[model samples]
Target: MRVAITGSTGRLGRALMAAFGDAPFTGPSGPVGWDRAAFDLDDAARTADALLDRDRPEVVVHAAAWTDVDGCARDGELARRRNGDATGALARACAKRGVDLIVISTNEVFDGTRRDGRGYAPDDPAGPANAYGASKLEGECQATAAYDAADATGRLAIVRTAWLFGPGAPDFPHKIVRAGEKALRAGSSLWAVGDEWGTPTYTHDLAEALVWLVGEDAVVAPGERVAIHHIVGGGLASRADWARDVLGRVGLDVTVDEVPGSTWSRASTPPAWAVLAPTPLPGREPLRPWPEAMADYALSLRRSRTASNSTTRA
Candidate 1:
């Protein structure tokens, strides 16, 4: 079906573009993509009007957000606008145009209480500990409220994911790869948090699942509440584990000095247990293991680095 993706320059947004391309599900989509210039979330009304009134896309993948964890705590109002207000505005516009919206969220909503290692389910209550998490929770609430008020409650599907990896416009995984290269040249090792736990989702896989979910048959069964759904990778992993796999794959042989989250002070608080539960059956194919995903990412980095190196040499 025809779909319009917000924040089309960001990690998951670009992945959605790569996964769906210009002509998704056959035929043309009228092909429109926007970034900070024409589709800033700050311009909520314009963004909404363009998608709802002009493009009239069947699906609006809402991947834009103020994801700066520390900065969010510093200036929460911006986060509220970007995370909550913009989404609320988009949801309202969707309601008016009878379009479905897929809002991608994070797993920081958990309070880190559960230690069963089973991860947090979609039905789990959100008690966010940080400004970033709180703002996202607010966005989820607003999107749902918009649909609920109209009695067409299935329009918004909030997909909560976490520790996302895979290639796209630069993000944490790429940053770490760069840092690792720097550390290797500097004869140093990477320091990672070993205490924090979460699942790492591949961006491409997550985007595919979101596109599929936006097309799924939701019965809107009683008490179902048209609520959030978990779309993260299958297993839980610590940040150190993720780093070790990344560095090891490149044969770096560098030490991953494990440290508690406490050692690395931050402006915002993080939920100690931010793991995302597995997607329900009939979701997507097996979630790619973080190690395997890391290998794939490493290969991508190698290719990109080589291209850059060749250009520089030439």
Candidate 2:
């Protein structure tokens, strides 16, 4: 299938590019990428038209969004415009062109109030606790509405993941590693939130899953046009647990002090228990455990530092 990806420079977007490059996606040149500079979401309609007219891709994976949680909380209007309105516009354009669309979303759509420690399913009722979640929920709504309005037969999938971390950008793992090293050098301990918990996903794993979904391998249930799937890391982890694991994996000796989520003053209030139940896809095994994924991430970080040091010496 001819595929195109938006936000091709982002954490997940980069991984998706790598995965698609290896996969057997048929096109004039292979999967086409549109970065923020080339395909601005602000001009969603015009950009979508130009892309569809030029590329005529069979599928478009919409991965671009304003993912800054705190920043979204600061400016709800901006968040809505970028996340909500832009998604609607793109969905409408896709619907008109009869193109399949896979929209990337987050677990924050749920309020995360489940007390039994169970993860939220794809079809669960949504009650966003913050502006970021609210805006994303609106995007989901807008996409669904657009598809329904057009009565489009094309496939529309909402793939929701959580706590993404990987190689491209300075994600949570990078932040923790830097902070841990700093605290160790200062002869102090690193404090991490103990109460807040969620799945820590690796971008590579998500990219592979998305590839499967788009390929002929994945089976869309009969009569289901709009499907929602919670594709996340296999297990759950608290913030402190994640920090300690990351530090230990990297051989950092800094002590991680566990604290409540309220210890830090922030613009956004993340859900405390936002774990997502992984939806089973046919012919595909579930994603590996997060700790296993973290091990690979730690190794990558080590290699990156080694390469950087070598370059500096040269």
Candidate 3:
């Protein structure tokens, strides 16, 4: 399989690159990576042209989007253009060229009003509460519309995930650990929201699933050309719970103060119940629990710190 990944510099994109590195895949010369400089999503016309004229991979993983929730709330039009229009352009190009597409989406599309403590399935109704989620939902619509209009014989899968944490980026786990260390130094405690809930997914694990989706071994059910799949960590956690778990894994003795989600002021209002029930591909097991993945991330951080200290000493 010839695979191309957009947003090559992002946390998930980096993991996808690393995951595909071990697989029997290649582009014209090697694996195709399109960072912002190489493929700007904002310029829809140019993006479509580039995809149609220049890089023609067998599968294009559309991962580029304005992921800043607060920023999206501040500029809804920008979000719509980047996330919605850009995705439409890419999808149209892919549909026309008969290239398979894997669109990476978010769990924010749902309204998060479920009080039953159950995870949102892929087929659940979407009612975005914020500008970012609305924009992503629009993107999903555009992609589907494009493929439908073209009647293209290419596979299209929308993967919705949540709370991704991994190495090489300051993700949620890293942020919590960093804040906890700072608070410990100040002899204080860290504060986290107790109401907001979601599953903390690992980027590497999600990337592996995507690899299988694009590989020959993956089975697309009959009459299912366009499908949606929820790929997330095994269990769920509130913000405070995630914070405490991260701190504990990293050996931080700082206390975590559990607070209400309302106390935290932000431009975008995240879903209060953001959990997603992962629907793994057939024959593939669900991702491991988040705590296990967090342990690996903590160990990686320690190794990195140790290597940096050794280099400094040398």
Candidate 4:
């Protein structure tokens, strides 16, 4: 299929590119990496015409957005344009072209008000407390609306994920690991927020699942014309606990000091708990646990550094 992915250089976008590159997606033109330079998404009509005129992709994965939580809180209008308005425009463009649309969203759509701590289901009500979450929720609404306006045969899937970590992106888990290593070297304790809890998703796994959803009939038989799935890691952890785990995996003897989430006062309010419950598909294996994925990720980073060091020495 002719796949087009926005935010092609982003954390999840890079993974999507890698995963789809490995998959058997036959097209007159391969996957189009549509970055910000391609078109101004803020202008819906112009964006649609320009993108369609350039690359008529069969599948469009909308992943670009203003993900900076604090930044979004500071500038609500920019956040709305990038995350909300842009997505709606993209969805409309895809619908008009009869292209399958897969919109990558976040777990922040919830207000962090879950008492059960079991995580938010796809069908649960969304009440965003911050601009970031609010904009994403709006984007979701717009995507659904655009899909509804399209012909009944087209597909639109909204995949909500959380706490994503991968090779290329500057994710929280990797940052924690780096900080722990530094603290270990300095014989100091690393401080992390204990109050906030969320699921840690591996971008590699998430990307593969996205590809499966788009094409692999063996993995998921299409049950809904427009589907919503919660795609996240199998396990949940507090920020401090997750940091401590990363430290342990990296063979660091440093202590991780647990602090309140409120201690790191920022422009936006964080969710106390925003873990996303992964939806099970028909023939796919369960996603690996967060701990397992983290361990592997840590080891890979180490290996990469070692290789780089060897090359430098030579």
Candidate 5:
């Protein structure tokens, strides 16, 4: 099972490499790395050609996406092309190649109308509120449509995950850790929004699942139709709680302050409760708790920064 990943440099992409390189075999053909230099996904036809014919990967993980939430609001057109267009092109490429296209979508695609304590199901109606979500939703539509229309439309596996955290890419926890350090230097309490809620997914765990899915031909059902699943961390928590846990793990005694979501307003509206659906994501292991995850992550950042500091001192 040959698996090709589109964005191999990003945080999630790096995590995929790390997790799978350990000792696993997924995909009909062995795993091979693919990234920007290989093919610019913005060019739909060229990208389609590369994925379908050039590499001929049995599974193409479309991890590349325009994930800039605020920037997306300012440039909706670019967002559409990057997130929707790039994803659609790859879906078509996979269809032609008769491979499985794993679309790593986001909870953002659903408008956060679900109650705070409740979880979303795969069949839940989607109503993305912001430009970012709208764009991803469009990708889902195109991906599924391609499969539904064509007999050999590459099998579609649209996996929705959320609140991603891990090393490499500057994701949510990394940003907060950087912020906390800066705030400590300034003698101020770290403040994060407390009201927003969603399940956090560890990048390593999600990558493992993606690779496993790619290896399995069973997911691509009759008609070569695509399958959709929701994969996230085992539980949910607010941004404020997540921050506090991270700070505590990092050995900060300073109280982590929480404020209403309105205080940190952005151009695009964030769904209040875009938690992932638990039902569709089958057989995934329960990820380590958020506190434990933060400890491991914090120490990694510390070790890296400490090494950098020592190098400068020398």
Candidate 6:
């Protein structure tokens, strides 16, 4: 099928491109990799025309969004425009052309008010604590409305994930490794928030699942046309856990000081525990544990640095 992906240069987007490259798919002009330069999602008409009239893709995986949590909190209007308005525009465009849309969303939609120690399910009511979450919630609403307006034949799947990390782009996991290394070098202890908890998702696995969802056999059965799936790594972990694991994997001898979330101040307040429960698909397998994923990421970073060093020396 003709597939298109926005945010082609991003962490998840790059992994999606790699995953689709290994699969059986095609795009309008080579692989449908549209970076920010190719299409500005803010321009609704232009974006629609480019995807519908020009490319005419069978599936459009909407992965682009303003992911900077602090920045989103700083400017609510920009967040709404990029994450909320742009998503609505894409959904409408996709609906007009009968193109399937798979939107990548976050787990920050929840306020973490539950003390049950269980992860958030897809059907749970969302109560955003920050502007970023609010904008993403708006995006979800717009996508759902578009699907409903188009008669809801399961043409849309909202995949909500959390704490994504991979090789293509720097993320929280990488930051942990970097911080640990710096602390080790300086003979200092790294402070990590112990109260915050979430499932860390690997982008490569997420990309694979997204491609599977777009396939012919992955359709939602009759009755429900719009589906919401929570695809995250198995098990839950806090920031301190992540830091210790990252340090261990990197062979760092640094001390990780577990601290409260309040110790770190930012423009936006994140959910203390917003882990996402994996979708209960009949035959779907759960993703690998966060520690295993982190190990792989650490190794990959080492290889990347080695290659860079070799190039510099040569």
List per-prediction Cα lDDT, in the order shown: 0.75, 0.88, 0.85, 0.82, 0.76, 0.82
Scored by TM-score, the top model is 2
List, residue by residue over 1-314, the lDDT tens digit for candidate 5: 56677777777888876655653464333456676666575786686785568666767777888788998999999899888987777776677667777888899988887764678778888889999999999999988877677666467888888888888767777677778878887899888888888888888878877766655444654554666788887778999888887766666565688898889768887888968756443454656555666666778766765775588789
lDDT of 3 by residue, 87-176 (tens): 888888888887888899999999888999889998889999999999999999998887777766877888999998887658787788
lDDT of 6 by residue, 1-314 (tens): 77888898899989998887777755334358878876686785577667567777788888888898999999999998889989988898787777888899999888877789889998899999999999999999998898889843338888999989897667776677678767876889999999999999999888888777765446454456678899998888998988788777766788989999999779999999879989976666788887777777788867765675588789
Instruction: Please give me the total number of clashing residue pairs in predicted model 1.
Output: 0
| Candidate 1 lDDT, 1-314, residue by residue in tens | 67788888888878888766733562464334556676667889776887567776777778888888899999888988889999888888887667777788898877776878778888877798888988898888888888888655346778888988766666656666677877887999888889988888889778767656654544133355455778777667888887777766655677889899999779996777878777663645756666666667788877766776698789
Local distance difference test, candidate 2: 0.88
Candidate 2 lDDT over residue span 214-246, tens digit each: 876352466776788899998999999999998
TM-score of 3: 0.94
lDDT by residue (49-125, candidate 4, tens digit) is 68866887778888788888999999999898889988888888777777788889999999998888587999999
Sort the predicted structures by TM-score, highest score first: 2, 3, 6, 4, 5, 1
> Can you give the lDDT of residue 77 in candidate 6?
91
Q: What's the CA error at residue 122 for candidate 2, in Å?
A: 0.8
Please provide TM-scores, in order, for all candidate models, with all chains considered together.
Answer: 0.90, 0.96, 0.94, 0.91, 0.90, 0.93
Off-target runs (Cα >4 Å) in candidate 5 are: 23-30, 216-224, 280-284, 308-314
RMSD (Cα, Å) of model 1 = 2.6
> On a 0 to 100 scale, what is the lDDT of residue 297 in model 2?
89
